[model samples]
Target: MHPIAQPRRRQLLQAAALGVAVLSTGCASVSTAARPRVVVVGGGWGGLGAVRGLLATAAADVTLVEPNEAFMSCPLSAHFIAGHQPATDFQRSYSRVDQLGARRVRERVLEIDRTSKMVVTATQRLPYDFLVLSPGVDYMEDGIQGYAEARAQLPVGFRAFEQMAVRQQVDEFLAKGGDFVISAPKPPYRCPPAPYERAFLIAEQMKQRGTKGKIILIDANPNPMPPAIAQPILKGMKGLYANQIEYLTDTSISAVDMGKRQLVTSSGDVPFAHANLILPMRAPALIRQAGLGERWANIRLPSFQSQVDDRIYVIGDSQGTPLPKSGHVAFGSGQRVAEAITERIAGKSPVVSTGAVDLPLGICWANVTHKEAININVSGTVVAGEPPKLKFTVDAEANARSGAAAVSWGNGMWKAMLG
Candidate 1:
């Protein structure tokens, strides 16, 4: 077990006692009153985590506002993007969330009225006592010239359902061998190792099918992201796909000329038969519209409460924190936020711990092949008014054990989220 989770266990025990005291002391006042409305946006890993924790408390009326009726995972969809698995493998219905008494609204959030405490949709507005925002991210198409008009040709596949489009591109590339371009954006993107993992899996396919093409992996960073997994990632890339992949480091995409199928990069213009331009990403427009933050929602540590709005909490990749943007971290952050909200509902202030306290743990896997992967784990500690101190443990090389564990972990998480 990670050290970060130990202190949290003790905190949970304390919270349970506090909750009981609140209920026993004021049974009549609560029994006759309306339940607190907790509005959760998005239906991905983090949103589902918040829903599960909120439902377990039975203290609030949870309403999940998601554009999609189903939940899809971006973590393991690299298999689907590489044509090794179907997209349905990483998708699940939200029937379980509904069964747990969460009101599921299948509509895009138009705006968040913080003062009114309501989330506005196109047709209706839902009032809330507390709001949880986990809207994921949006690509910065303007980061590259001509990318806006050529959106149809380049699919980033970072979000849910977008993997299918990238899979189609992969299929076409495999069928007709040529220069297939896959570029990695700068750090702080969703799943830092995903672009390289996508390339590795597709390169594996290239080897199996004897595809007469090269995968041009243009990385904006000098090494694999987070630095901890760079050596392992580079070793795997060189050892496994030396013939299939051509890695270019410190190469930034400046523009795209769709007419010529050329990517204008800091390195130079490179022509390709197919391109998957994983552009820079930022929090969804809703965050900026609500004055949350510029690039992401500015949130307070430990609590995840919005800096500008006390009633609003932001988790997952949307929050501007030093923590890694990973599904594991997002889900854990959701759970932490749920506990904080429940304490407020119980008429108790949140527990403010001084000294060192654990933050969320992040677990990410970079699948080098169909049956091999590299595991990365991140643990963190934070002081009251200081930035978090993080520690990373990454596998030295791709191995079969981590690959199998990756699948098992995905199954367990999906079950916890949807089943």
Candidate 2:
């Protein structure tokens, strides 16, 4: 357990009790006659967390507006991408969330009418007293020239369900060995280590099957990100996959030449039989459309309330924060926002803690192999008015313990979000 989580357990318990009390009292006032409407957009890890929490409290008329009827996890889906696990392993039905008394709307949010407090969809306009946006990320395709045209050929499987296309490319690469190119974008992108993790898992398959190919890993940054686990990541790459992996750092793919299956880079022209170019990412256009923020939603710390609109809260990778775009952090932030909204609805005025308040711990992992990984846990704290401070606690090396824990962690998180 994290030191901060243990100390804050008492406060969490108290908040949970308050939530129950609020809901119990709401029952007497007619089911949802007087309750406020909470419109949660996107049904990924973050939205599900908020939906699950909000539904428990019965504090609001919660409507989860998501395009996808089912949920697919981007985190830990590398196993599926590398063909080590089936897609169903990382996918869960939304039945549990719907069964928990949430009105699940299978529709994409076209716009956010801030003034009217209504969410515009193609077929409906849903009004809300409070809104939660967890729209995930959109790729910056312009960074790599010709990429927009060659999207089908070059699948960036960073997003959920898109892994299938990348898997096809990977399968083709493993069978007919040649250059399998994988690119990593800079920070503020979704899962900084994801590209490398995908490479590692695929490299493991290459080694086992004796595939005659090399994985050209081009990184936009100087080292693997967060910078804490770079050493171990590099160690694994150099020590284990030296013969199979060619690492190129501080390089960006300026153009994609899918006609010849070559990527134009600053360093040189690299050819690939198959490629999974993980491009730079930003919050979905819905954020900008809503006047939330440009690249990401501008959110106030601790509360996750929008800086521009007090009624709107943004969580997950879509929010512009120093926090790592990890599912753990997103889910935790969603839960925190649920508490904040409930408290506000319960007529409790916003109270800022004077001392340093502990924020959520981002528990992240980078798998060196299917059975070994390096754990990186980031702890954060913020003073009443100062910027939040983050500290990284990382494993010294890739170990089997952390790898096993990573699977357990993924299972636990999936259970929490969907079940």
Candidate 3:
């Protein structure tokens, strides 16, 4: 070997050995020994947000526990009901999340073992240093009599992946032409404007297809719940679908006789050929089983830390916050919860105290027609001594601009969630 080359080779070997030693020492450190494990339940907007954030962190070993193989968005699902968009447009793959090093488990969480800090699934028990639950909402079947048994026919397409079922029914209604009844439940449900948007979109289809049918929208509240978007929603209903949609306020579907196709309401028994009963919603059964709360998981604001269980963080529509149950709020809550977990792992104090964390933000849309929409933006803040205050900024009326923006937002959000 050349004299200079021999020295250079030795130097290269020493550098390689030093690099290996450093890597080994780094791996042996307690902080790197086992990266904090974060298991996120549900793969909806909120869950995806947490997973993405955790993946972005080098300190987290993220595991996404979702039963569905793919994600389907509840937002803009009205278009599917109206046949303007296909079901595939909302469905997204989990492959991107998997590629990000998140252990994607396609299994439903059976129970949460708070004592062991493990989530029990059918196949395996997942151990997590931090847990985030965003399982979304479930309908309260007790409010309306005979609803549980007739749930199949009376599709409540509020949840993701269930929109296709309602869309099929709506398609049949448009083809056959009958009384298409869409009922809106009280406030605090998932997507407050969804039922109205569904009505307007379907009514637009009715006019274009000449379905010879009128949409009967029975709202539980006197106007719209949360009151802020009432003017815009009512304006859309009257101005856009005046002839095709009939708005009934202060009326609720108390009971449903599916065999007879009649709905008993506060006003009176209404007969309908096809119906979409958006039932009252509550937290998923797992939440109550885990002793979270009756209607929702009682969480400490900002931290999203569960009041019942400190190790668990509940975000999205599943938590009992006075914020609107929109995808925007869910996504924001997910990111907030992930950051809180990261801070905890780093042994750092929270930027915002558990007593006074900023409330989640909400962005919801109501389609007045096929080409126009009403948008609602909500910002909430929590003070040390006072309850959370939510402010709503709504579009004056439905317009083509908002309609186009809604679609763009949907595309961007879906990309953020799945891409």
Per-residue lDDT, model 3, residue 198, is 88
| lDDT scores in order | 0.84, 0.82, 0.79
**Candidate 2 total steric clashes:** 0
**What is candidate 1's lDDT per residue for 89-173, written digit by digit as tens?**
9999999889989999999999999889899999989999889999999999999999999998888889888888889999999
Q: Model 3 over residues 73-129: C-alpha lDDT tens digits?
A: 898878887898888888898999999899999999999888888999998999987
The local lDDT score (0 to 100) that residue 254 gets in candidate 1 is 90
Give per-residue CA lDDT, model 2, range 133-187, as digits (tens): 9999999998889999998888888777898899999898899999998998888
TM-score order of candidates, best first?
A: 1, 2, 3
Q: TM-score, each model? A: 0.93, 0.93, 0.90
Ten-residue stretch with the least lDDT total in model 3: 20-29
The local lDDT score (0 to 100) that residue 223 gets in candidate 3 is: 90
List per-candidate RMSD values in Å.
4.7, 4.3, 11.4
TM for candidate 1 is: 0.93
Give every collision pair in model 1: none
Candidate 2 clash pair list? none
Q: Tell me the spans in candidate 1 whose CA falls farther than 4 Å from its real position.
A: 1-33
Q: In angstroms, how far off is 274's CA in candidate 2? A: 0.8
Query: Where does model 2 exceed 4 Å of error?
Result: 1-6, 9-33
How many pairs of residues collide in model 1? 0
